[model samples]
Target chain A: MSLGIAIISLLLLAGKQIEEKFTRNVAGIDMVIGAKGSPLQLILSSIYQIDAPTGNISLAEANRLTRSPLVKSVIPLSMGDSYQGYRIVGTNQQYLDHFQAEFSEGKTFEKVMEIVLGAKVAQNLGLKIGDTFASQHGFDGEGHAHDEVKFKVVGILKNTNSVLDQIMTTPLESVWAVHEAGHHEEEEGKGANALKLLEEDDHHHDEAEHHEEEQEITSMLIKFRNPAMGMMMARSINQNSTLQTATPAIEINRLFALMGFGIDALKLIALVIIIVSGLSVFVSLYNSLKERKYEMALMLSMGASRTKLFILLLLEGLIISVIGFVIGIFLSRLGLWLMSENIEQNFHYDFNVLSLLIEEIWLFCGALLIGLLAAAIPSLGIYNINISKTLADE
Target chain B: MIATQNLTFAYSPSKQFTFPDFDCADRETMLILGKSGKGKTTFLHLMALLLKPTGGNIQINHQEISQLSVAQAADFRAKNVGIVYQKPHFVHALSVMDNLLLANYLGGKNQAKDKAQSLAESLGFAEHLSKKTTQLSQGEQQRVSIARALMNNPSVILADEPTSSLDDDNCLKVIDLLTKQTQEIGASLVVVTHDQRLKEVFEKQVLL
Candidate 1:
């Protein structure tokens, strides 16, 4: 019993560490909007960089939100370029400030077509300042490489342990220019003429307002002065707005809550498994006691105390629980690491190893409590062992 | 030395036992021989104070164990007595030395590796000092169990069927070694068994 208690206690210790980290990552952000797909997927792709973007919105609509009374700063993002599997996200200078992407090598992008790579992207791709690398046409590296539109790696971001660590960011014009190089007479049949696109692509100005059609935007990341404004803005967009307004923070909360149910269920299952394992330990010790009653009897006659027998049985449960706790934590950490890689490649989000969440701590505690409960019954069984009958049987 | 006065015990409301007073003086080896179902082990247990006697008292090394508090009884048990079982049992996960160390620690005996190694050698378990008890044979495990019982050098040893699985020669060897160790340590030995072969091995006799 004591052994079971000890095992669960150790797992709880590790779970507590994971929980603290998860809570910190979810501390900020409210909503995100760009495409018309899942609100969760939109928020995940735009804010956390964990999913694919829904679709592109007109740049005019993305920027016009800034004029609204409820809106604050709309951080427009244009993705779909990569250097050796690492993603390249083109955005305004505010992105560098928003995520605090510092330059470890040279300077942030100052010239058009200049690129800034994330620390991991740079390290993984083996590119430095003055190095030129062409981006793959799309974010997933499935599209053709735009070798003609080569971008110079002007800057390298310092490791921030976030989504920014594995991405390459450049001016939003870079994304348009990459696609503009492949424009031909065939694709210009129904869409806007390639000549006008050439003029718009040549000059770097807010030309969408002057054009009959609006500019295309992959997504927009909005930051509000008052966090509550996010709800009002989202409500307005959902009501009769020109475009969809998705809150990254709200979506993330709903996601966590929804996942909390699933996680709570998983945690409950893990806890139950731990208890069953602990119970197996208890049964093992108690069965040993039944078989070794005579041995115990003989020991008692020889001077071993009843309490020592109790402790000995309890110790067995503790050992098993401890073993289980260690294995369970190791497995959970491995599970998190495995999930991180897929998230990085698919959505550009990297789950950090060091940061733990609050729920993980609770999970660890629950494991410990289960261990203790399992071993308690067996430890008490030692008291009932009748030494005389046991010795005679021996 | 050990003594029991008007000792009694009951397994349940239906089963009960009462025995006359008994005692073993210091430095004595008493062979307790009994028939099957005659409560021979029960009498041995009564003397060890393992059971709460519904009536009377048990005294070992001149201290009344029945009057001792729970903790005191535990301390007194660890210090004053040891037992060797018929079938040796051990904490299988631990190595032989670790099992001995656990016994020593829980028994309130010294936990010195050097001392345990030396003791193992003295008992002819020198090469198997680090082996798991489960890896040892029945006889070898018996020796380790005996080693555990003798670790604290208690004033008394209660061995139940100590040589149960042994051949005649090995049985005699075990009896001699255990009695010799007990005598050297000034501990009274009480051997409980159904086999009468051990009756001639002891000077004192308690028959049931």
Candidate 2:
């Protein structure tokens, strides 16, 4: 019974926390446009960084969306590499400004291969401002290492309590430079020559339109000045181009709807357990009342009113409910803390379990009501005891 | 004092009882002797107000009790009457001391812990005061029941077949303690029993 209650409260608190965090993350971005695939996968990959990206789209084509009167800003993301499971997001300064990320050490990345580490990334990796590391090919932290292209950490961000805290931020040219250099060194076995290409690449950052048509990015995070205009533009983009547009709000709602089914089923099971516990209380009290019928009669003959005995019996139920509620809450908090610890290691997300939810107050009331009703049914026998007959028969 | 006049009761239409008139003044003792099937407990219950008589009136301390309502009868009984059953029963969960205090609590009087201690002392159960009532022997439990009856210092005490199961030796000893305790409280003691051994014990005896 307590396990049921613990699972119920834990689910409620964790579910609300996840929903709030997801909503806060998807707040500013109106739509995500990426290579053609599942819209939800695109949002989860590009925005949440929890999944594989749906291939890449041409940067020049994605950048054309900024010309639209309704478009406010478009941030291109190239995410194929990671440092020890933390994705190194390749984007411009607008992406950092979008999340209000504040640096704790050093400054923003300027030259190619220079990177700014999120707080969690810097702390977990124990990397300082001047430290440098080679990038891996994929986010799994097990892919091929680009040892030839070492990126210098110039800055470390403060804890934003968002996906940014689990990622590395760099200029888009660093991704292009690393992969192009790594590809050249593998083919020609010319490692030192790749360093010359990187230095030349840094000088061409402003006039990169010459090769912008060929450069590709994983996705684009687009914000529209007018929300209604996004709906129309999203439909046109999805129909005319190979890219797919996914609205963050719509995809996240679908995600929760899918998750709610499991939560509701668990709550139903918890409710059944609570009812069964109440029934057991009833059965035990009812059986004890039979054994104590003569005692009840004795007290009555000794001047105890039926109401007093009734309340006495009711108190047994009340005590059971209060104890069950207190233990249930304690167990729920323990369960949530363990779960949040696990999630923190895996997803860098923290759950605040300290706040007392209103739903838990209602759960306590519901438990007490069941307990009282179960006890009241059996305690009614107090009024029916014939004092004279019970005393004589005993 | 406790008195009854032509007290009558019927469990059903076929089972009925008619009792002879009797009265026991304060500081007095009376015995109603009968066989097992004779309604000896019925007459005692009538005086105790545990049951209402179909016809007749019972007066305890100058108040008509047979006409009292269920709630009123319970209240009146707690304040003015105490009863000892054939079998000594205490709330098994409570200690001997708590069982004695229970009477005072139910009677709506201040809990007289000192009186309970003194009663346990005089009744010779003071050593068992902190023990569960179930831990006592039959004789000790009976003595504790008598002490509980006197805790409220009621005006009347009714014992229904209190010694029916006790041996002759224990019976006389319990009777001696019960009478002595009632005399100290100035409450009339009425013992209803089917045991013939008690026939010569009391001066005022009524046979049914």
Candidate number with greatest lDDT: 2
Model 1 C-alpha lDDT per residue in residues B90-153, reported as the tens digit of each score: 7666788987776677676668688678778878888998888888987788888888887887
Candidates' lDDT values, in order? 0.70, 0.89
Q: Write the per-residue lDDT of candidate 2 for residues B12-121, one digit (tens) a residue.
A: 99999999889999999999998888998888888888888999888999888889998898898898888888899988889999999999999999999999999999
What TM-score do all the candidates reach, one by one? 0.73, 0.88
Q: Which stretches of candidate 2 lie over 4 Å from their true place?
A: A1-4, A104-114, A119-132, A151-155, A188-211, B92-96, B127-132, B135-139, B164-173, B195-203
lDDT of 1 at A346: 58
Off by over 4 Å in 1: A1-45, A48-75, A80-87, A184-216, A219-244, A257-261, A356-361, B1-165, B171-208
TM-score of 2: 0.88
* TM accuracy, model 1: 0.73
Query: Which candidate wins on DockQ?
Result: 2
